[model samples]
Target: MNERDILIVGGGIFGAAVAYELARHGLGERVLVLERLQPAAGATSRAAALLTMVRDDPGQIALARQTFRTMAELEQELGEDIGRRTVGALHAAPASHLAVLQARAEVAAAHGIASTWLDKAEALARAPWLAPESFDHAVFFPDECYVEPYLFATALLRAAIARGVRCEASEVKRVVVDTGRVWGVELADGRRRAASVIVNAAGAWANRLSVDLGLPLPMAPVRSQYWISEPAPIFPRDGAIVLLPAIRAYARPEVGALLFGIRERQPAVADARTLPADLAGFVFDPDDADGWANLAEGADELAPCFPALNTLGIAHYLTGPSNYTPDRQLVVGAAPMIAGLYVASGCNGSGISFAGGVGRLIGELIRGAAPFVDPQPSAPGRRGAFDPYAPDFLAACAAARAGKTSG
Candidate 1:
């Protein structure tokens, strides 16, 4: 019986951050992290790693602020570079979507985030590969950057481990509950462990662990895929991330090559129960069969952004589950009736962006400290009626992705 004060399941960005924050609050020696696979090896590794902080949601803006600050602090404390590239992000929108852009700028202003509107010539100067004629408006967020998500999560875990938090490679089959409160977790081998508090930060596969709970998170898994181009000088390594809302596309510099992804009309939705422990075991394209059709669908829209987009040598095609809720907000808070049980999943495809804040909020809740930001908007019970695996509910979640043009 390994008794601990805090036990966190899943060692992705969220879990790692939670463990690190708990250690920072003087709960290091008493914390335990159980990661079935490797830390950040799950969906966290496949994250797009975009840190576009000027978001439409003010809460997200506030949370993103903490994440940006925490990244720098981790680099300083750990004495290692997290590989953060401050190339900034350019949101290029058409006339019809100008209102949305303006609204986001206003929100950024209120949150003290720097946002500046750039003329077509200036925007083109930032991303020469992008087609200036395709967009009617553009805004630049100089603080934005694309980082290596794996490095970020592992650095947090390393710091937490240095503070005496123990982690083991073991899967948690279920959480132990008695007297309507969580006590510990039951492993696959029928072994039980004791912990005073348990936080579920299990990324895309989180629903599998929470379905039996009285209050399961109202979210489902959706496939988020992206492609990388072979090295090409046409793709500048120093260029800013280009976001085209009109065509539903985003591109960033990837080591002298171009990396990009375009949202599909109906993104693939999967039941977390059917997903494999290793994300590589899952297949994303059943309809397209060979996968070329899906590739072509996205390429057509992004073709105008780069002249060689269609002809470029595609070096890699990466895909992973990005959990989503209908409202497009994170699900991070304590379980409704399961005392001492907290969930920090439901990233809505922004897990990497929100991991720091999620960890901080969970730490605050468990320690009874005042939260840095309000967490009610993303509470579990706010919209919990939908069955995550149901067809209609999955459709709703996929619809959210289809309509999402920005971040």
Candidate 2:
């Protein structure tokens, strides 16, 4: 048996970030990361990687701020450009959502984040691609940023490795638990690696691993699809990220093209256990015509804002599964029923934005240090032992994905 102080499962953004944070806190030599495949080969690589911070929830807003600050400092600290782009974000909604938008802006202000409200005319002036009179009000977060998620995650892993953190390419077959305490993990090769603590940051596959310990986590995997349009003359390469929450649609610049996605009224749920053992070849669902129609409807709503989308040619379609909790927040913190076990999953589609903060908080919990943000809302057992595979839980996860706000 190979022994270690801490073992983290999954090497997606959350896992990479947690590993980096543990190493940063001087646990480098004692930490180990087990990745089924290469890092970020799953949803992390497929994420749109938007980092908009203006949110209605105070807890999420604080974490967003912390993640933004941490990501800002990482380049200097690690001496690597993680492809962080401060392109800002423009969120627009109809007249009915004016109050909600105002409250969100207020939350941003309270967090010392810059948020400027723009009327239809001013909004159009800033973004000429917007259709005339398409939205009544809008708010722009100038400090909001994004990154290439895979690159960013890899950068964190690289820095952690520099500090002596070890990463192995191995699939965890099952967790080895004894008397309500996790002591190690059984790998696919029938090898046992001992660890005093285990962090489950497995993203969509989280519930499967937790089930091994009889921990019924309320997290499910739902498919999220997006389209990347070929470079059009009307699209701006450096334009602010555009979000139309009223229609559940968003778009951002991808290189010289436009990357856009829509939240279907009925989100598609996937059984994580049945998914490809290696997610490297995952692709968009061709039979999901309803999803494409939803995107068309969203484009129609934005015709007044982005007229070019009406005639754009989609260059590629990308689809990946993301984990969601019943309440659509991250699940982080120690497991109440099990000793030496922690969870950092159920990102609800904000894994990239929340990675730094979540990783830091998980590190704090493991080290018995005071956390910068409260962990109650994100407690792993907060909802108390529910069947994650139950019909109702799955339905709730789909609904949560459709209406996900912090993405």
Candidate 3:
């Protein structure tokens, strides 16, 4: 049996971020990261990489601001281009979310997060890709940007490894619990590894891991799909990530092409045991081609304000799943039923934006240190026993089935 001070499962953004934090704190020698597949193969790889500083909540916005600051420094320190492009972001306000947007901008400004209300003409001047009459107002977060998610994941892991963090390609099928504490992990190869503390950064499989430990979790998966427009030299070169308020879509340029996607209005779930065999190197089928076609139409509908994005080509498309909580917050903190186990999953769709700060906070909590931010209400054990047939679970399952079409 191999022994480690801390064992982290799942090598996606969550695990990679935690490993980086442990290394940054000079604890890398005691850390172990076990991945069933290559790193960034899960939701991390498909993240839109939007760095929005103005969150719907005050605390989360602050946390995001801190994390973005840290990411900027890390990119510089590593001398790697993790694509931390601070091109800014625009939140179009439909009648439904106008007040919410106004309130959020105020909260962000009070905290020194660069945000302002932009009139239609000024906003359109900056991002000539939106429809002129699409939004009554735009809340611009100048500090919010985007990052190349795969690069961010790999760069963080590289830095951690350079600091002596150990990583292995092994599937952790079971968690060993004893006396109400996490004792170790059991791998599919029948190898048992012991750890003083266990961190379940296991993305979509988090709830299943909780059940295996006799501590059912309230988190489930939500499916969000995206598509990349074909290469076009005429697309807008410099503009904030544009959002269409009424249509629930956002579009940005990627490698001389445009990427667009729709946010799922509802949540979804699927059996964790049936995860795709290959996390990386997956492709989209022709039968599902129409699924992302409408995203472009939505983008075109908002084209008057963003003239540069009025017409574009289709480059490629992909699908990713996000872990959702009952309150639509994140699931963080120690497992109430398991004393030595902690989880930092269920970021909904904002995991990439929240990864850096979340890992640091969760790492501190696991080591009994004071957390940087007050943990939200979506704690892993906030909901009692899990029921697969419950209303929430059923909704998640249905969405998951509908989301199966992917790249």
Candidate 4:
């Protein structure tokens, strides 16, 4: 059996970032990452990679700030550009949501993050393509940024590997536990790897792995889809990330085009356990007329801010599954009734912006050090009697994905 001090399942951004943090904190060669496929092949690759720091949730806001700072400095440390784009971000809302937007701006200011309120004319000046009256008010964070998700994740993993962390392209068949302690993991090829601690950052498949060990996690997988418009003169190459909370839609610049997504009123939930082992054959739902309809309506709402969206042709469409928790926060911390086991999953659509902080916090927890932020709200064990597979739980998750508050 191969022995490791810490074993992390999944090679998405969260797992890669954790490995980097562990190495940064002196764990070095003691860490091993087991990836079913290449890094960022899952939800991470499909993420919009928006790095907006202003959020309604304080915990998420804190995490986003930390992640942004960490990622800002990572390019220098790794000697590679993670594609950090400091194009700024604008969050706009209708009159009914003005209070919420204003409150979030205040929170951002309190955290020392610069944010300024803009009227319709000012917002139109900043983003001339916006429809003049799409939003009643808007808040712009000038220092907000984004990164290429796959590139950033791979860069982190490569940095970790350079610092002595090992990554294996192997599938974790199951986690081995005995006497209430994690032993390690059994690979699909009948090989066993021993480790004292295991971190399940398995993305959408996290709950499935937990259930296999009789420790079901409170998380569900929901489909997230986005569309990319063809290069159009109306879309600026350096446009700011524009968010319309009222419509549950967001748009950012992508290779001279506009990349956008809308949260469906009724999200499609998937059974992670039944997913095919080889994801190469997986096909996204191309006939999602309802999803497109929602996006069309969202475009109509955003047309006042971005008139070009109403006329632009969609060049491509991408879809993938993202995990969500009941309360819309990530599940990070030790698992209940399981010694030497930890989890950092259920990103709730903010994994890219939360990766650095989540990785650092999980590493600190493993090392018995103080976390930068309180982990109680996001603790995996906090959801007592929370059935992840229950209808209500799924509904709550759906609501969260749609940018609504639910528990």
Best candidate, TM-score: 1
Candidate 4 has a TM-score of: 0.93
Q: Between candidates 1 and 3, name the one with more favorable TM-score.
A: 1
Instruction: Write the residue-wise lDDT of candidate 3 on 177-250 in tens digits.
Output: 98888789999999999887889999877766778566776656655567776666544666677766555567
lDDT of 2: 0.82
Q: Write the per-residue lDDT of candidate 2 for residues 204-267, one digit (tens) a residue.
A: 8888888767786778888877888888755677777888777777888888788878777788
In the order shown, the candidates' Cα RMSDs to the true structure are: 1.6, 2.0, 3.9, 2.5
How far off is residue 157 in model 4, in Å? Answer: 0.6
* Poorest stretch of ten by lDDT in candidate 3: 398-407
Off by over 4 Å in 4: 1-3, 119-121, 277-305, 404-407
The C-alpha TM-scores of every prediction are 0.96, 0.94, 0.88, 0.93
Could you give me the TM-score of model 1 versus the true structure? 0.96
Clashing pairs in 1: none
Query: Candidate 1's residue-wise lDDT over 1-407, tens digit each?
Result: 24476889999999999999999888889899999998899888987888878777878877787889889889999888997999988888879989877877788788887889999999888888777667889998888998899999999999999998999999999988889888899999889898879998888878788878756677888888888889887677889998778777888889988888888888888878888899876776676533467778876667766677767788887888888889998889888878889999888888888888888999999999998889898887677655678888888888888877775
**Model 2, runs deviating above 4 Å:** 1-3, 119-121, 281-286, 289-305
Please identify which of the two predictions, 1 or 3, would achieve the higher lDDT against the true structure: 1
By lDDT, the better pick of 2 and 3 is: 2
Pairs that clash in candidate 2: 129-305, 130-305, 131-304, 131-305
Question: How do these models rank on lDDT, best leading?
Answer: 1, 2, 4, 3
TM-score of 3: 0.88
